[model samples]
Target: MNERNSASNNGLTSLSLIGDAAEVGISPSVQQARLPFTVRVVADDEALARALAVRQKAYMRHVPDFASTMHIPEKYDREEGGLVLLAEAKLTGSPVGTMRIQTNRFRPLAIEQSIDLPSWLSGRMVGATRLAVEAGGPGRMVKAALFKAFYLYCVNQGIEWMVIAARTPLDRQYAALLFRDVFGVGEFIPLAHAANIPHRIMAFEVGTAERRWREAGHPLHEFMVATHHPDIDLSAAPSLAWPGTSVDLQIPADPADINSGAGNAVRRQPACTL
Candidate 1:
């Protein structure tokens, strides 16, 4: 009778442990809920237009002078070594947010025009620009989803560093995301490529992003590294650089839209990942 009781207690203990784990939301299936929107590569001119609209709308609220000319897609949108990501509402198909990513595979990064990068950051770099999202709850979520896509793209392309020039207030959020200043901390550099705006240049190490966040106990650590976000789609993304080297060089015509909004104007508070 005691042997049977011990077996029964063992079974109960196993069931109780599983129940406890479930309560803590340990399963990926439980944590991996769907996002209200989906972020994907801008496939064609039409999709690019939608992304541009989102950019203009979000920027106009803060920087009307720059946003006025953003009605159409920028030259980088069609560039060989660059791509634009768009987050669209799954229910309404409206563009919720957008971010433009360009690499230095063929030419130097846009920020290079302003300041020279150190030897460590000279190669295999991806820069993000024109990041904007609608002003609301959906906008916050869209920004997080877009960043996940950015991180995944960098990983797939073997990008060493992710760089960006952010304006005031936005720079603080970037700091929270584990982005360190490439130059002097808290010093804003005037980026000629970004309309001579005094913006802070920040970079995130792609290879060490997961480990750094985990070690630091970052708030978005789980959302970034642990959770599997299916809403971020990179299927149509152009390959910027491979694991070991840069791809074949392709120089497009100098369409002359390079010096656009690097320091995009958005008034939204930095939410989940910013």
Candidate 2:
């Protein structure tokens, strides 16, 4: 951890996915030849397809029924205020991980349909959905990198809270990351946007991530904060532009009727809200 912080703070160019390249006996030139992985917003149809493929494959392993619909991208993928993050192996250009992050800019979050968010959770909140990763070679490491990308995006966009509806067992991972239950502990709510699947609603305060981790001596504190991942790119582009305007979404109060658009392009409101 100290080494990562030193390298990052000193602006070293030999950073690796999980450790320094030099420590792994790889020459800088060889290390630079291939990117370990890349994290970026889905910008084109091809990229979206790759993301969908990974999402489907990963979800199928755990939730086959829900995974069926994931073959095609959803409406929220292109929402101006929401974007999909795809991680690909540079060597093959194949997606290894994917996550959909949607901010509550114009409408309430998807989980809101199942349970009302407290006022404290209102405003500048971002929700991560469809988080999936290939189950090989440093899968945990890949997940960490993807999370770092998510954290950076939230910071850049001034997102306050990072929220998710995690399923059983998977919710334990978020708990290890210090995410708190948004409603009740062990209470699983069926999410409308998730094929009526039950998930535990959880949230992490974005702005307090650093402080909380440091104070708690969190296991991921160093990897998340001290380490710098240049591979995770969030540069602005045509498709990557954030939708600054709010879009009117007809949110339903009942989880059964919550039909939050997934792959569809957001119908932009005249004035951007977020």
Candidate 3:
């Protein structure tokens, strides 16, 4: 972790997404390639497709049989859920890196196989999955931006807690973001680790998180409040009176912004109620 922070990163920057390269009047692409880059929500299907395509490229470059990565179709255009994000070059309008968000906040456990634990039986607040960022090319910054977008979405949705299977490299960073290892507090059920990364668990109130960002050393704190998600409370409750695999779990609440507004897009909200 220390090496990642101290290691000098070199790469060609493309900040075309924000058109702020010349204005920052500082930190040209040449000097800083790893990031501190702006985050943008992708709306156009064409653009979203392009972002996913770029992610495929990066994934293929590293992950074996990269072509197998399923291409995500635009859900927003269909009046659905899910979000896509992009990082563009300020000077060139070129796409640099991207990430995505596919939430199912208040959905019932039976509706989706991924979420089997019932609310009352569950421990955390929200469950987040499909957090894929383009590898390399300032990967950490790109990842942080993706997380920021998701954070704002959760806040807008009135979410009080968040859950995830965080990559090991991000253990400390996620901890800083207020995500605790699974079932560490209160009566909780732990998710078994799968893939190479452990399913890192986290929970935090939006207002509290905002305070932490304010009182901390993070520079991208503003990103935490930029996006807007409608109030999405789970009204969570345990599915069964006690733990049992045979019984189906249940949480009577609205599912999250799974396929909303065509991938991810810039959201201007009346300041995050942080």
Which is the leading candidate under TM-score?
Answer: 1
Q: Give lDDT tens digits, candidate 3, residues 89-200.
A: 4456556666554444333321133335435334324544434554554555556545655665554443445555544444555665655554454223334422232344
Candidate 3 error regions (>4 Å): 1-38, 72-79, 105-128, 132-137, 184-198, 215-274
Off by over 4 Å in 1: 1-31, 241-274
TM-score of each: 0.77, 0.74, 0.51
Q: Summarize candidate 2's per-residue lDDT along 63-175 as a digit string, tens digits.
A: 88877888776788887678888889888878899888887876777677777887778667889988898885545556766776677666555566898999876787778
Clashing residue pairs found in predicted model 1: none
| TM match of model 2 to true structure | 0.74
Reference-based lDDT, each prediction: 0.67, 0.65, 0.42
Q: What's every prediction's RMSD, in angstroms?
A: 13.6, 10.9, 12.7
Clashes within 3 Å, all models in order: 0, 11, 33
- Candidate 2 wrong stretches, greater than 4 Å: 1-35, 237-274
